[model samples]
Target: MGQQEKVATSLAGAVSERVSASLTPVDEELERRYPGDPGTRQPVHTVYVPGEQFAADTIRSWGDRALAALDEHAPDAASFAAVLGLADDLAEPVYTRVRAKLEREPIEDLRVDFEDGYGGRTDADEDTHAARAARLIAETYAHGAAGNTAPYLGIRMKCMEAAVRDRGIRTLDVFLSGLMEAGGLPDGLVLTLPKVTYPQQVTAMVRLLEEFERARGLAPGRIGFEIQIETSQSILAADGTATVARMIDAAEGRATGLHYGTFDYSACLGVSAAYQASDHPAADHAKAIMQVAAAGTGVRVSDGSTNVLPVGPTAKVHDAWRLHYGLTRRALARAYYQGWDMHPGHIPTRYAAVFAFYREGFEQAAARLAAYANRTTGDIADEPATAKALAGYLLRGLDCGALDTAEVTRLTGLTLAGLQTYAGPRRGDLTPSAK
Candidate 1:
């Protein structure tokens, strides 16, 4: 201490004070706009069911049907592993975890699709279905039975297009009003505003949600929604600017996510139906822009779905399963983290790919994070930012049933709080010698 204290800086303390004062507002602005990850457990995928078909047993039915598919086609861990081409070392663990996840929490998040999936019904029919969907969701959450309800539940209403704008608002109002009457909205409640093309569309959604909160006596900004980026104009505007960035700002701090609409978006670019896919170059370009725009805004970006359903003969189903798995795995590697599931049959391969992704990287990520936190020399010698990424990877693994808490603690020598600290904004403040 004596030797360190003996050294003196050439600049005066007043200079630093002046610089800090000059940057105070800038610092605050940065913090407000970019708060980093929310440090919550994000769902691995979103399952969309047509509004009219939603029921009390929807989640369980999906799980059961997926399990039945597994039973009839793959039948066992080795067989399932072979179908997906899982590596030898990861086969048994991934298969077992996928089956368990399907048996347990088959749907992480569920959305009642009142848009394309529901198509155009009479106003009365739509109204009836919307209320029914809300009632069913409320009942599911009210039961509070483990594995009985998806953690997050909501409805994806029609777009803000001039033709459907009022209908979308009316449906959202009915759905939220139903939830309020049931027992207040669940903490895990989610909403999606689909086919958003312009910044004003997002602003209109915010105002609608604000009006709903006032009408229902819920807290201001209590209701948030995903912005469905289904059009090229949503990504890039006529003025030649990144329109999605403005869309996020237009959300007024209420946008929860940016969900890619695979088919709609592909169609907007005039891709033939046969050529449309989540992995298409257009999809990648759009999602890549989306990823960058949402990097630190706490707004999640979800990849779109594969329309190919894993059904029919075993061979045909296997082909579809492979495609889904490959797309999911690819999306994960690109850091999309969440996506859409169109069919019950897609559930098994979804979990399989998600589980295998985390499990395969578990050991390396755990070691790297542990080394960073403990200040140990390692092969990677990761910096603070890299450490944050490693910690996030491990946390996502833990959140989605991919990694066990006890095992993670044992491997990393850190508690959940410690890992969260590493994954969060204050990570840079952690010194090399600090745990």
Candidate 2:
């Protein structure tokens, strides 16, 4: 095993050693650990990695380096698969397996992209006009030529501030319409309205899409997508904080996801120099709020990109640093554990992030809770007895450094209520997350 792979495996195995050693079935001792109804626990988690997460960038880059190294020893490079595959019968390596699977066959839904706005302009000079026209043609074709089955795509409106100040156009209505057509906002398209200082901005944009969808002969329900929650106003007044909910209500079903407008939101927070949403303290808190607001409802929440943009090759020292620092590793990973892959590259991390977080720690705790509720083995499940057992399991897991509540919910379906009553973590509540 490589040094990095060895580190990850040894750490994970060491953390899960006790559970692995005690594959012991639920018995009297187990019942005492968790007095709960049996057979009630469900496989509550579903994979939530963004297909095109920056993590994908990380994985792909890592794969490139891995393939380069492996090809030296083994020929048939294209068919060789991942580095872990090189080690036959050498299973139980999560990092290598996770990295390989993500790099080779990236999941579908995890991919999300923001469409750049048009830079069209009127110019008297022949050369200038030609340059603008070329850009327009290139972008128009680019959108069309790109692969379909979009993980998710959001189109930003061209600079309305410039349109208003320089060209004296106020509403951006005509410009937006033209840009939409140029970008091919056909049926089932999700449009993102940026720089929205007020709810009305979003509502008006929502109306445009509704009208456009109808004009295009697209079924109304065949549409209804989402937008990014980026602007300073939107971030400050998240969900319950402002007219954001009203804007969402206006969107009808067209609004399905909300992304933290990291850079812009951070600027609003008065950070001296602008930084990407993932880096700022405000971004973290805002993301939590947005996440909570979208929770339970079907609306998905996404964290903004690392805007530091992967420089150099993947698996490089810088990429590792980005993973460690620039990324909200624990929070984002926790969300992944709960089945929300907010970024594309994050999808691969989703598997490990989730399994490592839950595995025996979350799952076992939940299973023990379920076993406690079962009276078939003759012990009754009462508030007093069950709470003690549940508390005992939680304290032990917490002491051992395990704190995933969503898994607890899966085990008992009673976690939320318990959380509300006891003020304990629910649904992987490392801290009050999901705005």
Candidate 3:
């Protein structure tokens, strides 16, 4: 045999000898330690409203309100026009298109909040409100309002603190009980557990959910929750170990996401109220930590919101839109695909910023992706890691309706099916250039 063939034969023989002599068996526990696959659908943003204000038609009304605000402030989409640097004449047409999209898919997720948005009420009033909110959700589901509501719908319970733990649990129990009684639970129903500072809290919440499933005769683990990383303790425990990872571990495979809370997290960090914003350095650091801890653990991380809401007279509304758009763009740059919207006015800027971000980079990303797929280097060389990132970007863009499948396919020379299948890391059975 040739010298190269002899070297290959020698290496194979050595590996075979090592494998035959090894006494250790494969560890099943280690094999199952990694997290399972993440959810297929992650909403672009979640709209939070007071529990008392929630109803089956709330999302549709929110869209209508947003459309009216868009017309009043920008008069045929002037706000987006300014942001996109389009001419005045194009504003109306652009506004029309955006308005249609808003009317069709008003919100991707909606959270009826009992924490921050729902202020402290008398005990009787709180209980009454909880029951009312539960009935609203039930009626919404019963009357087919689920079709109009966002794909992901749930409520944000009060934090699991000593003072409010019972209240929180009661609200969750009532809301869930009502929904279950209304025929069945809605698909993609999630509970938002705020102010998560310890792993034990996650464990307790999981146990409660298990009890809920048992009592309701629902499928086990049907209810999952998203943990809010709103406090300093949630970043690092007293012992200095990462608390986010611990929380995920404590969740026992039911933690769907980690959502940042801007004001509360900043307040806990001793940040001044004047500077407690989503893009604050301290907030960014916390989010970065969350990203690291949740990476590959199937826990999606979301950025916080801009409380400088768009309200009041025309000029103030314009200013608020500008600020919201800038902050949203910043969040998008930091890879926070999801955020919280406090008001209907924020919707226009949200869609505008997201669409613009995806549109601005489409061509270059497509070119590079195409080059990588075809095994040909383009203007900028594409590595496997960069290719995977490009593919993910396109996929997210498609998911959020920012980029169409045909456009992506035309630009990247890969059909939608092919892009979905072969856009990421290459498998042993699939060739990189085949798609």
Per-prediction TM-score: 0.95, 0.49, 0.87
Q: Tens-digit lDDT track for model 3 on 352-425?
A: 77766777788889888998899995578877778867877787777666677788889999976666665433
Regions more than 4 Å wrong, model 3: 1-4, 7-39, 77-79, 83-97, 122-124, 138-147, 423-435
How many clashing pairs per prediction, in order? 0, 38, 0
Poorest stretch of ten by lDDT in candidate 3: 426-435
**Per-residue lDDT tens digits of candidate 1, residues 81-197?**
999998899888888888888877888999999999998799999999999988898899888465567778999998899999899889998999989988899878899998888
RMSD of each: 4.0, 18.4, 4.9
Better of 1 and 3 by lDDT: 1
Clashes of 3: 0
Candidate with top TM-score is: 1
Native-vs-model 1 lDDT?
Answer: 0.88
lDDT of 2 by residue, 356-424 (tens): 343335555555555654432324344545554454445323322233456566665655456333323
Q: Is 1 or 2 the stronger prediction by TM-score?
A: 1
